[model samples]
Target: MSLLADVDFRRYWLARMVSLTGSLVTYVALPVLIYSVTGSSLWTAFVVVAEGVPYLCFGLFAGALADRLDRRRVMVIADLVNAVVLGSIPAAWAFGVLTAPHVLVVAFLTQILFVFFDAANFGALPALVGRARIAAANSAVHGGGTVLEIIVPGLAGVLITLTAPAPLLLVDAVSFAVSALLVRAIATPLQTGVPGPPGGMLRDIREGVVFLSRHSIVRTQTVIGCLQSMTGGAFMGQFVPWLDQTLGIRPTNDARLGIMYGVWGAGGIVAAVLFPRLSRRLGEPRVTLWFLPLSALAGLACGLATNWVVAAAMLGLWAIVYSMVVLTAITLRQRVTPDRLQSRVNTAGRMISFGVGWPVGALLGGLVSEATDPRTAIIWTAAMTGIGVVFAWLSPLRRLAGEPIPDADETPTPAQREPVPAPDRIEA
Candidate 1:
């Protein structure tokens, strides 16, 4: 069946698009709200910290909980929690009691909820779509989001100009509520029958860690993913400064900067459109091996481009290659993991790659730019992605370059196995 024809997947796709569009608004609006309230860049910076810290703190635990409980319920509860927490912002504003501290706390709490929401969501898609269609499904979903991303920020910026930022969050709060209802409507059996770890949450987490360690493809890709995130973080961290130094562009030139980034997003949309077909022709392993290195080269070109047109073209290329690498890695991870371990393992990988890698790379990039030239920093940061090529060669993923994906109907062995009756089949 075509993915869009699946009722459950349609609901899931709609939920993601709605939530992401709303999130685009909140992403711009929240900082605006914080800045308006405090007039302090320091407090505005704290919101970024608040948003990140929760992912680091709660990511693994959230993954374990998602695996242990009913994933659907976990997602629903998380959405509702986010709705209430975010809804409180407008409520406080209405009461004339809103403060920077309140917004920061809300930001932190909502991110913690997102950890749970995402951990559940990472696993939920594979269950809904089946392994064979994972690539196409992910592509379609990301493609839709990429298109909206291009438009949503501009719209959000206009909305913020005309209305208060606090009320903008109400839109996000309502999106979460709608997402919850849509998720609750899915009839798929999201929970795996693999027996729970006997010890505790830590044990469950350890099991995920061990699986990630032993699984050659996941380990290689996870490390590569971290490096990719670091490179991306560094490039983006230094982007504005590099543009100013290299092209005489300033933040005031919002149109030019927006176009550059929009071009990058356009590349991502193209990658999403092509991913499934590319996976079919080259196979997942070759796609990974080739795309990682290609993205590094593309990043270098982007850093060195002197003309706006050339820079946009290079940035677009980098985005396309980099996004393809990411999509391939995620599809591979989802395909190989067992149902029970999916959330725990995937979320653990994300915590390592995203939570830790991005901030570190961004900080390092900023330091390099401050110590030297922004162009040098951009080139150095972009070049660091080449390390992924070396890592991929040494790991098991190299074996997959020409390999077909494993049978979709098969289940991988969990780290620990108990002798038990077979579980009932759950339709995708």
Candidate 2:
């Protein structure tokens, strides 16, 4: 059966669609809101940094917890928590109590909760659809999000023009509540691995970290992912200001900006549709290796484009190759990770790529923007992506280019299994 035909997978997809559609609004609105409040590029970037900080602080714990608890329950609770947390934003705005710090705190807390939600989500799909369908399943998820990326930002730009960005967050809050109900209705939990003997949470997290560190392909790809994310975070952190100062686009005159965002997402849609076919032909690792330089070139073009139209086209092209890298990386991680360690290992990898990488990039982008110009900062960000190209050659991903991912039914060799600690030394 096709992955979409699976009842549980369908529910999960819808839940993701609803929540992410709303989030696309907030993603645009948050920066617009911050820029409106502070009028400082640095502060806006700082808020973006705040969004990633929680991932660093709590990622491993959240991932470990998702493995120990019912993944569905973790996702459900996370949605509910996010609803309450995001709802507070508009509530504060209504009372004239909103501040930059308030917004920063909300952004941080929401991401912390998201760490758990995402950890559960990363593991759930493979369990629901099986290893053979990982690429297709992820394509659907990424494709849906990309579609929203195309639609939501244009709508959000219009809405932000008509109304304030603060009120739009309420929509995000409501969407989360709805997503919780949908997630709760999924009959089968995705991460339904047989329960192992109880290990301390720290121990569980350690096992995941060890697995990632020791696996050659996983380790190498993960580092490359971090570099890619750093560039990505920098681009996003500066995109709004770049639009305003470089292209004369603003929340009020947002058509050009919305179009750029939509075009980029459209590129992602193209990537998602083509990824499975490409992987079949070139192998997943080869796709990553080949696309990395293309992605960098796109980034370079994005930084250098003087005309908004040219910038939008470059960004759209960049999105295609960049999304391919991201989707392939996630699929690689999911395909190889043991079922029991799925959430923990996946989340640990993301902690580096997203949690740490994003903040560092954002901070550097902000500094560069403040020190020089937004355009130059963008160029620097693009230049940073080239580092990944160099790393790829040295990484195991180069060696693993044509290897097929092990099938789910295949038993792992003794070395591939996770190591166990002796009982006496084990912590409670």
Index of the highest-lDDT prediction: 2
lDDT of 2 at 41: 88
Scored by Cα lDDT, where does model 1 land?
A: 0.78
Q: In model 1, which runs have C-alpha deviations exceeding 4 angstroms?
A: 30-50, 87-106, 160-167, 192-199, 237-253, 256-258, 305-309, 369-377, 407-428
Q: Pull out the clashing pairs in model 2.
A: none
lDDT of 2 by residue, 1-428 (tens): 37778888888889999999889888989999999999988988988899888888888998888888888888999999999999999999999999999999899999988999999888888888888888889999999889999999888888888888999999999999999999999998577675445569888999899878876667777898899988888888998989988987875656766787789889999998999899889888899899999999999999999899889889999999999999988998888887888898899999999998898999999999999888888899889889999999767677667566554356544433334465422110
Model 2 off-target regions past 4 Å? 195-199, 408-428
lDDT by residue for model 1 (223-298), tens: 9988988787677656656766787654332446556656767888999999999999998888888888899999
Residue pairs that clash (backbone atoms under 3 angstroms), model 1: none
Sliding window of 10 residues with minimal summed lDDT for model 1:
419-428
Tell me the TM-score of each prediction against the true structure: 0.84, 0.95
Model 2 TM-score is 0.95
